[model samples]
Target: MPLTGRNFLYLLIASGIYFLSARFAVLLFSLEPGNIALIWLPSGIGLLMVLRFGYWAVPFIVVASYLANSAGMAAVLSELAWLHTSTAALSNGLESALAATLMRRLLPEGLQSFQDIFPFVFGVCLVSTAVNSTILVVNLVMAGFFAVESSWMIWLILIVTNSLGILLLIPLAQAVLQAWESRLQMRLGDAARCIALFIICTGMTWLAFDMFAGFIFLIMPALMFLAVQGRKESVYVTLTVTVGLTVALAAENYGPFQLQTDEWSRLYLLSYLYSLIVLVLGTELYQRDLLSEVQARQSWQYRAHHDALTSLGNRSLFIPLLENEMKRAERMNRAFALALIDLDNFKSFNDSFGHALGDKVLKEFAQLVRKNLRDIDVAARMGGDEFAILFPETPMSEARHAVERLRKQVEKLTIKYHGRTIQFTISSGLAEFIPHEKHTSDAILGRVDQLLYEAKRQGRNQVQA
Candidate 1:
């Protein structure tokens, strides 16, 4: 119950952050540190939102903004406060929600590290900004500022500038929150990168003359972080930059801080866009690197155990494990069987057709035997046209039954190579190894081989026990 409650609280916080962030972006363009001092507390709660929740979070955000604006409006003008507040919230909500939804669809497959940050930001944040900014423009027009013809210029400026503002804040927000929470696995190197990101964001916030220049310088450090750092660090870096920029602008009494409504809105959208791109790119790069490492290791491991052609476990890995199992079974006073299977008329088929057909026949025969075995059972190709199964806790009689089934399955299998179809059967030998038997692993394998020879001698396609 406690866990559930904590989770609920977390959801509220995250959703609130998402909502407020969108709302704030629409209203002020920039989330001035001063303006958001009280409101920004809700942002961190989003970590608890299930991935599915990022979709519905937009509307809640819009309402939060409306509430904030209403409170502001009431503090000053009491008349028509409700109407203005609702209009503000709805416009922001529609745009932000649409963007978040689009992002959810294009969301990367797995959440890795810094590499995925950029793409995620571009998809979720930039797109969201575009949507929300458009809605903001429409709302202004609806308020009788102008018709589409007169408002088109303002709309374009609002969309582009605000989107940049939102993009800028994303990294700063990510850095502060993610770092404080220790969400990213950061060693000395990651810490250095985060600090570097802070410096760059701060410099841009303090030194840059125009929005475009601010973004260009600010995003450079972010791109660097995304390309190299892991997920947590990348987000941390983005967040920190965003927060720093907002704080700086507010301190200077610029744009959102001074209630320069248009500039504030532009900055807000840009900040969100920055955050979205960084998040996506960081995630992609990190996951891609991890997947590559995994694949490399798996390939190395497979090469050790499996036949290159047939993908059946080869002699090196299979024989030793089988021997160990046999030893364990003997100590427990249990019985087990090793069955040796040899393809009959294999050489003849190869002579009549080709070595390609022979290889195909061997692979098909291995598959057939593998399909007949239990999941716990180990099947291996001892050599060309030769295979074996270690049947744990089985007696001689049961082993013989298994061998018969295998033979029948093999007989049913056919291989086609170069349009020539050839059928083949296998002869199997079932041999039991008991505790009292004076047999080494080699001796047991040799016994099965001898039985296999006997089966071949008796006839080409029968099981000999």
Candidate 2:
């Protein structure tokens, strides 16, 4: 399936939201969470890209990391802003791109479970963070942000904490967002239930706030709803909790419990950043996982009904299609036809030229029929040496013209076996199904089979109705 422009926009928006939330978390807490390192930063976004478009994670991670480092350096360090920005941007962008690529290379050949996520996060984000942070601190000293004498200590601390934080919090944030999204999807197509859940979850989050404790615990209950019911419920739960916390915190600051300037800044920025990043990355990953599931299912269905060798519709697929056409013809009082084509003297060709040559002939014959047939017409291999074509909404006269062309073209198929050129001709038996006049698809097909036998009897390389 094609990914639309809207899909790309959605992915971009989701990643942007997550990056903003990460920044918010830093600003509000005044103390950055230790676990941001664990959750996998842009990797979550990259994972989503791989899932949705299958090849977009590389660019998405690069841009996201670059933007994140640029913004973070500008906010936290004011002096030598350009120097910090350049160094940070390079570290961040390279780390994210490399992480995405590395994870993609190590990908398991199946859907991932909750258990698989932690290892992926550790390997990609945590490892990348360590390397990137080292480069960043080294650059900082080179650019004189810190003296060469003290840079080592600061670099070590920065690398350790940042790497650990990324590996921890980023994964949690991603998981929380995913849980919430699953809750939301469960209520899909039910506007009333969705809105109701939204209101209720919001109310609950509001009631759960305490003076010293943060609203972080609210993510737990919300995740429960998502796990049990799906994304629709999770969205309501997360939204309600986040909104309630925001309102509660904001209202308190203006009253007798007014917060200091730094505190207020921290409160708003912290929760906002954390929520945004987790939500966006989480939702994007969830959607991508859903897309992957759907694609796998469709692929399985296609494989089940198609010939493994040639990818042409197999007998299993063709039979039902033929039946459908027969029904349509009955309704319209029109006539359609089925053709049973056989390669003349196929056994002799197989014996003389070898089975490999016979197989080549079969594949070439299917290809020739594909070129000759219209999209509305379906051709399938019944088995070795036999093929069938079902012409929908076609009368006897039109069917004959189409089948004759196909027959002529197939006769021209040549194969090289054992360094010798071998050619073959085909015979076809065509029969028309006249709506209610023919009671069953089997009956019509049986008539075509008889016609095929008669053609073979009259001598190979002929079509008889």
Give the number of the best model, judged by TM-score.
2
RMSD of each: 14.5, 12.8
Candidate 1 to truth, TM: 0.45
lDDT of every predicted structure (CA atoms): 0.62, 0.62
lDDT of 2 by residue, 60-139 (tens): 55555556666555665667766666656556556655655666565443224443444554676557666876887787
Tens digits of per-residue lDDT, candidate 1, 140-233, equal 5655544678466555555554444344444445454656787556678766765676666555555543454345345555655554554444
Backbone clashes in model 2: 38
Model 2: per-residue Cα lDDT at residue 327: 78
Error of 2 at 118 (Å): 4.6
Where in model 2 is the C-alpha error above 4 Å? 1-271
